[model samples]
Target: MENGSDIDLLVARRLQALRTRSGMTLNALAERTGLSAPYLSRLEKGERQPSVGTLLQLARVYGVSVGELVEGRPGGDYHLLRAADATAHQGRDGRYTVLSGPRAAVSVMRVELPPGSRSEEARHAGEEWLHVLSGRAGFVLDGEPVVLEEGDAVHFDSGRPHSLANEGDGTVTVLIVSTAAPTPASHPMPPASREATPVTAARRPAARDR
Candidate 1:
């Protein structure tokens, strides 16, 4: 069995490599990930193990799977992530923990939202499914308000603008799964005023959806 310290060292080295490749400073990454510079510094030094939420944020930012970041390879089909080894992030309202392998067809996360708190709306490429684990969750999809209680779930296209919030006077926990699609490419064509045909929605999965 791998010890926590060894795992932390592996992740530390990989995190540094990814940051260098992306040309992102510690401060820059901290700002983007909502982590403190000091905390990030300690992580890079192999003094801490990042939370599942932190790993998800980093994977989203770097376009790599958590497996790749932590294992130095696209993990083979079978891999196990123990709860003790899972990465995590705690905020004033709640916490987030990633449960799926990085860069998989589907990414999974456990999210906690505090009462009266809402998440930042993200419009990107892919499809998302969310299951409310506990409490009341308020979802706004393309300007339509949808409320979900415990045991309820919702699925939607990622292109539509969406955000989630906690509706009840308590914390809400949800399991969120995102399936990625490739973004359509833009091409410039020669001027032809003839009636243009509307392009059909194309589906391709890529890493930029987060």
Candidate 2:
């Protein structure tokens, strides 16, 4: 039978494994869980035990239950997610915070781009949608550039080259959701419109973004 120390070790190992599998560094996990990096480091090393609140917060950030955190077993289908629990990171020209889902499959992220920042053109295998929550953004799709304002939404094939830039004076925030697996290409690209149609509402906010 496992002793109390062994259980602690198992919990630590599971937490560390989850963080690594999620492609998060200690600093990244700290940013997501709102915990100090040093404290997380100690927790991972089994040198310290986290409070119940801290454990619950970490579990939420990892998309797992508190039982999973302690028992080293997969929890139920229910996932506890919160917007404040996302992992934030600084990219080349902007800052991004993951809102929900997993990077390994379908993922959703909240992105903030400062004025004058431009993202490089790139292509992925999946499909993606971007909704402007605040400010305005300049998006380039298939060599064409268009300005998107608050409430504007765009959906496209990720296989095509695309980029995003912030031309407005203030910061721009967008909710971007994508699937890692490739999807069949059906409709062609549509003209850029100032307003997002109501049909796009079918893609509701992820559990965490709210």
Candidate 3:
């Protein structure tokens, strides 16, 4: 894993690629995205971590999903990204790496949930498949909490409010593939609350090492 920097240069490259593929100059893209040219330029250069909300806006303008904006070549008979090329992104929610180019039907992501950290509560249209790759964590669906350990996996509808938490003392890494609807195509985003609120789970027992 490339963890030398917080900036995900892969996202930077992909953003520039998508914009170039559409034959749009930075100025044109700025006009289309309603984002200032300088800010967009920073995003393309990996100088700033693009927030989920910002990615949503760019996705709509590029006719793609937030996942697509962070992935590899996008579409083809097959998609492959060398391990060294994978970019790790640090976000308000947590650290994640896009595992594949967003498909017409699904988006795959590898997420890290730090101990005592909880992701923002979010609900969207469609379904989700989650597999715990390491450590133990809590997956909250609506108001119920389900504890999962390494190798545990679950698939469920994503329509109900849901969030993930690393209630244990160690971080949990999960592979999430979702076919859920992204922020609606036209919902206005509040700059103040870029990502919904992240709720901390009540203190709980830490998972013992395997």
Candidate 4:
């Protein structure tokens, strides 16, 4: 069986690999994980140990099971996502990392804002939901500013002019899910090609000795 130390090493390696595969900078991962850049850097370097809650949060942000995060493999149907596999995009005001789902019909993203980042008023076709996994944030939807805290969830029409901001002293981490099919103008794939692909489960590895 894998010892606790072995599991810790695997988790650390997986975290670094995922972030690198996603092309996420340390700053980007920090933004996505609601952790400071320095802290994230330390974690990646194995200089710091994360709390169980922190590990779980990172797993969710990467759309991976906690077991995958710790074991460097999946425990079931889910796949592990790393900060390295995300496509990072930035606007004039805010930054976001897009973690595309296996299917193109939906997209998951991690968004981060500086203490007061904001976006221009714009609208799109579709619906979006934001779940605040950590920190505090505020959203301006159609001119109304709604504050959100950790564990808070909000859903809104993408066609409405909306913007977000970090309302607290630190950064805000939000898991954004978009339920819009990729459009021809935005995505080149056909509808049939946008469907989710099944991920086969793999056997769990034997635990290593400590």
Candidate maximizing lDDT: 3
- What is the per-residue lDDT of model 2 for residues 69-117, given as tens digits with 9 covering 90 to 100? 5554333454455666444444444666545432234556677888887
Residues forming the 10-long window of minimal summed lDDT in candidate 1: 181-190
Q: RMSD for all candidates, in order, please.
A: 10.2, 13.8, 7.4, 16.3
What ranges in model 1 sit over 4 Å off?
Answer: 1-19, 22-61, 66-74, 91-93, 181-210
Worst 10 residues of 2 by lDDT: 182-191
Which 10 consecutive positions of candidate 4 have the poorest summed lDDT?
201-210
TM-score (C-alpha) between model 1 and the true structure? 0.58
Residue 159, candidate 3: how far off, in angstroms?
1.8
TM-score of each: 0.58, 0.51, 0.60, 0.47
On TM-score, the leading prediction is 3
lDDT of 1 by residue, 25-129 (tens): 887876665567898887778876565445545665666665566566455666677888776545323567667664545677788887788876654445678
lDDT of 4 by residue, 29-107 (tens): 6665556788777777766665433443455456554444544432345445676654333423455555543443455
At residue 141, what lDDT does model 3 achieve? Answer: 74
Better of 2 and 3 by TM-score: 3
Error of 4 at 111 (Å): 0.8
Q: RMSD of candidate 2 to the true fold? A: 13.8
Question: Residue-wise lDDT of candidate 3 within 18-100, one digit each (tens)?
Answer: 88988888888776555779988998898876643355457655666556786544566777878987777785467887775
lDDT of each: 0.65, 0.62, 0.67, 0.57
Which scores greater on lDDT, model 3 or model 4?
Answer: 3
Clashing pairs in 2: none
Count of backbone collisions within predicted model 2: 0
